[model samples]
Target: MTDADAQTAPDADVTQLEELSVTANRVDGPQAAVGSAISSISGEELEQRQIRVVSDVLRELPGVAVNRTGPAGAATAVRIRGSEANQTLVIVDGIRVNDPGTSGEFDFANLLNLEVERVDVLRGPQSALYGSDAIGGVINIVTRKGEPGPPRFRASIEGGSFKTMTGTASVSGGTEAYDFLFAGQGFSTRGVSTASRFDAVVPTRSLDHDGYKSGTGLAKVSVRPTEALEFTGVARYTEFDADRDGFGATSDGYPFAAAVDNRDTEKGKQFFGRAQAKATLLGGAWDHILGLSYTNQDRRSFAGTDLKTYASLGEMTRFDYQTNVRFETQGALPASHVLTFGADHTRDAVKSFTAFPFPADAPNPLRKHIDNAALVGQYQIGFFEKLFVTGSVRRDFNDRFEEATTYRFASAYTFDQTKTKIRGSWGTGVKNPTTFELFGFSGNYVPNSDLKPERGEGWDVGVDQPIWDDRIVIDATYFQQRVRDLISSETVPDPGDPTGFVNRPINLAGTSKIDGVELGLTLKPINGLTLRSAYTFTDGQDATGATLVRRPTHIASFNANYAFLDDRANVNLGVIYNGRQRDLAYDAATFARTSVPLKAYTLISLAASYKLHQNAEIYGRVENLFDKNYEEVLTYNTPGRTAYGGLKVSF
Candidate 1:
């Protein structure tokens, strides 16, 4: 479909969202018919922009913040609409990928855009449709599917500064009854120093280059045994290793003192698989789907010098089963009344081992597990063919915490004559505490089994207007969220040792608030030229009236793309700006917290591609074009100017 058609289409599903289609409701419909703020990026567009990492791709999105600890392959956190890193839910190919062992947060540093085809970002609470950990929003990643044409194979290789190298290969094809797709990718880089440079009174280790390497593979297969039944399966795996620095005390009193001869290393692996079966019944008016999914993650870290050694290992396993049913009305007001119901069960378990005090002794292996079941239902109706409304509810039962119920209501109205649409939504969400929060370590942390779940209520209203015969689109939205029973670490008296104190998790009585306004504009002034821009203003504060750390008050981005030579060549340019933010610093000796101001910075990027032949292409990209010196986190070093070039061939 043409860009204009894709942008204006009213009825779009998950597959169409990346093509400029929007669907507010999970059951599927036109974006104009659902009441929620949503955004999406197509895989084709991402490839054109030379966005290789998941963190880089999400940096400029509205109402989103990406904080990286260091350069590439370092720990990265994504916050949505002022929510904490663990409050947002991330789904890959219909499976949740959050690491249960790490406060239930997903690290974007290791997620590469290798076989991804589309990304749908739904802003606002989504607990009613997606159970726990969806208090902020939901991110859905869809992978490429085989095409019903001759088999195709493609490969590409690239190298750049920092001794970075990358290679990718893929094969896909489909027939009348069967289809399959397989892809593999590998990347390696001799990264820069992860720690910032600081003067030290005592001699310290010389600046050493950290390095990272990763390999990933994906496979998918689908079959249609009969006219009424279909089956599909998917599998994915990734392994990575990275070198890191250590934190030590310096004579200057800075807590983030560089360790001499640091030789820390981290290794991790992830695997996920899913199988699904779908059936159509009652003359295609009713549909049923059943799916089973499994995920496993392992992480190991080694730190310290020759005389002393510290190591830790963490592993997590998850199993999930889900079934869904949808019914279509036989009679309607020129529109269908869709009803959907689903249930799911999930079990998560973790095992961890660690050695403390310079390889002297090892602590007992820690093991924990949690399970939850949820039932969800949704109803959608259209009246007079111009107004639509939807309501959804979910009931969840957790093995460790109290049961919870979440609900959402939304509506949309369209003025076809003026090409204007108004939409609004209200919802409630919840997040259960992680295992580590409930049960602490051997010596450092204390357990808090009495902790309650974090609760949130939020709402949003927005409008979409089309101008210049739908060639230009404008969107504006306002949203607010209040969170109760905020969880935080607090110093408490140690029961086992009356003379000592320890850090323990506690639920605060006061509430935290987050509110924001988002604005976006898209213009297609010419057939081969496109321009887009987005801006967000956020106000995030704690109950004590203190600004949240690492959250910028203002964020904006502008992008332009132009194609020439009969669509054989294209150039893309983009700029991102982040405003000053408030943060905190702790004293090395006293451990006293002090407020700090983080300066703002802007970055520019450029990418270009040219078709060498009917089945081959050449591409190149420049990141941080001006080599702007900035840090997303204090005491962390960021990458400077970098460039890469690659060639791709398809048959």
Candidate 2:
């Protein structure tokens, strides 16, 4: 009786995924109506996996790569679709957190998961909507907002290997006219050495452990006097301290590749705040948002235990305005059109100096500032409930660089019979040089004020298919990109001394090209059992036909989740494999760089949780289950076989 039914069953491998909303751009709509490469990670999933760090969640995505130079609270980077780390833009509650004083890249370290409701990721060039620094993609973190309910409190504490301890507490409530939320978190860890024994010329020398500590606080409030109008304000602050080791002479040896023990320390503080007013008018046909955001980062580096002097600071202020209008045709089969307009203004200021009694000293430092303004517009239309299309354009005016224009086009079509969706997109992006790159820094390097902005363009096409009556789903996409005007350093004639050369920044005439394929599959074979997998193949090359550094040719991941014990107990298993890649190594003796091959490796994790009461739960997880010894960075040591247990209570 079962054999005949199984053979005739509809093989539709799918669930309803396109019903989600896409918030990675100024224009918001259902995912099925948008033609970009996008994905969403929900808060429930993050809670189940206990992934406290955002970059850990990004590593398993189809086309994203995350790597840290050392352990927790260290310098971390997220790269997408073979683009450089600095090319990806990150936003936290409508505030841009990228560093303006340095390389203009956002470091993912110390970004704990607090009150995050969802994460939306858009992959591809998006300068048409976001302006500069979006050549790769965008990451938007949406936090939880207060709803109409009674006051609630949540708190948890956990300690594990490496002398690591973390705790968080939050309180939230809301009424018809007012809502408020407050939260705080703290973390500290005694980490492994950043400079490993494998990298040392003197293998017998023992290294000292470098540690890190961080604290954060957040507050949010909203006032809704009317159903159609609301005002919201958010403010968050974080402070962190990191101990480190470097390459230099030590007590036991000379010219050491990795220092055994050093008293170097780095301290940083960051603040992000935003205020906005939202209104819906014109009989529910128009929507508008007006907002202002500010970001500040302060950092100091000390060479000795006494903490003597080198400091830098960066601050950014931004203003935004947007409007959206919708029109619908009256008919049995209704058609719709939407139009969006937006504007952005930003200012940046930075200053750096050394007061440690050296040539780098600048008691009265040189402060630099710059301003930029941009205007953008978008149009979208859908017909027959099956076909959708969009067009976007942006113009940017910079204080230093030339005026830049960017645009994007996309289309999507869904089949009514089988529910298969086909989508494609094309876009261009630009990145202006940072303040440090233009008129800052001193000593062995010279700043170039004539450098032009980097420019890039890319495209992608994808298909979503279902099989076994929506039980299994598969999606695949192919993407390609080209970038030019990369900045590099070159030797120039020394102006102070004869028979010597100095380094100066210049724009290279060559271009970089990247092409890749991303494939994903999800299967729900039985109740409480779900399986998902992803694989990516990337090929990146320079204009001289050389492979790009730190880009793996192959990457894959698999995860399994199941709930047993009447859905009160849950377990999850995850496996990730990274292929071999090339990295540059510098010789301490000659100060020359050479390419070195890094070996491939795999990591596995296991987690389980049980509910004791409706408002109480206990959970634990083991990371690096096999204790695999592998290095993501050339000489940095990653953790091995760590375990943690915690309890959660809410009322």
Candidate 3:
């Protein structure tokens, strides 16, 4: 049997509900005793929303923002609670894909949407469960696996304004002992004409040449030799290319740099396999999950230039192998007291290359290696019929960095026979500076070897209640966080340089703080109508009373769907609103405005779907219904109204 079949089969002896989870060691409910805030999105919603990239789907959540340089396959990054991009962790099937050498974070432009089965966003501090790169949160992408019997296939094609075109296909098949799945996606866009919104004029020399292209593929296979043992393997690859203008101060300001290739491209491959066994002893049973995951990445980047646009290319390569062994007690102390233990190890080899347009022997590249090891333990206990608590700790040691320890504590209380629940959790998070931040070339930029691990602490308190005969669910939560030893560049006068400039990392200000409240509601008033809404209010600042840049203070969203003509067809509509934010200045004379106050705009989207057959459905959507004009940045513009329609067939 495949993983999906195995998941559906539960032991008749167990009395607990089959819990599905990715953030915790134990698969359980969200309200279960744990130290993190986890959220999930299903494949159906992914298809309904027509989300082509991971960042687009994540932006629907509270306190999260995505910034794209331009177009679909351009450089993209995410910000959470005012934290930098690299502060968040991106994982695929328990395998880490973060580059150890660059502060550049993972861009979803390279992912194939057809292969994604589910997404889990685990928020808050996760250093105890994962290691570095978990200060802000963790995003886990789980791909589709096996098909039941005969070969299954699906294909979709869509086109819209700005010459955008997208296509995706997937095929799967299997027998009783083995199964396989493969999927691929390709997309291209002409991009928005920046000249239309700027103060420059040209005949076909438009800044709109910022087009993009990307491709992705995924494959998975699983085999089972016996009822008690099974094996699974998965691999995926992606590449993206973009042509954009350089990051110059102004469109006509001295032409600081020319547009070299301006290609932001990356390729990554991952393979992971797992073996599991089951047995029974002493009226209790043991289920083992042992696995190994390896991943590799290659990245190339360039900056636009003065005449014909020179290129500055940077490349990073990483190799990781980890073994995870987990054991849990089946009937420990009446199923109320459960314990879990696991160990992990990883080794990484890194190399970085940079080429300038004018220099042939500027500086040699750098090579380094990193290794990490950790051991963790967690315990969950139910003190009484209405009270529960969980605690966990982990010690991590890295070869190139100092050792550190992280921990978490959480508690939950049930009142009125579990009709109402209150939970709170506190944890610590840590992150190591990427290799580029520590060992890059030193001309105008300098690397700091004295840097220490950035640390953070936070807690979340929430209440969940069911009302109106369980037809309505309401949840409210408040969170707060504080981080220390933040790294930033400090400029000083250069004695021998012509323009006099030198930059180095400094542990500026002692602490940065963020606090917010999130409210969520789910209501099913009639039989066929459902409504969901969420709102988040956030405040972020440092000891100096200056607001952290790029973090908006208010975000709100609502979605409503009503089934028409018998539950076989339906229409869904949604609206999202984001408030303005303050922009920070990197230099003295370059402050273009007192504030980059983004205008508030509402995006309206409509989706309609009808089932053509028992296993086939066709859907269409009109996004940005009003063609609203907006900007997430100072000069960059977002896409206008667009329409798409597709069909989905599952068997």
Local distance difference test, each candidate: 0.76, 0.77, 0.62
Model 2 regions lying over 4 Å from their true place: 1-25, 197-205, 248-260, 330-334, 355-364, 442-446, 489-504, 589-591
What does the lDDT come to for candidate 1? 0.76
On a 0 to 1 TM-score scale, where does candidate 3 land against the true structure?
Answer: 0.85
Per-residue CA lDDT of model 1 for 33-107, tens digit only, reads 667888777788788788889778776678888888787898998888998888888777766777777678888
Worst 10 residues of 3 by lDDT: 9-18
- Residue-pair clashes per candidate: 1, 11, 5
What lDDT score is found at residue 400 in candidate 3? 72
Error of 3 at 518 (Å): 1.2
Point to the candidate with the largest lDDT. Answer: 2
How do all the candidates rank in terms of lDDT, highest first?
Answer: 2, 1, 3
TM-score of 2: 0.92
Tens-place lDDT digits, model 3, residues 212-331:
777777778778776555576666666666655433233354222212223223333323333333332333433445555555565544443223222122232222222223233355
lDDT of 2 by residue, 308-358 (tens): 456778888888888888888867867778888888888988887655422
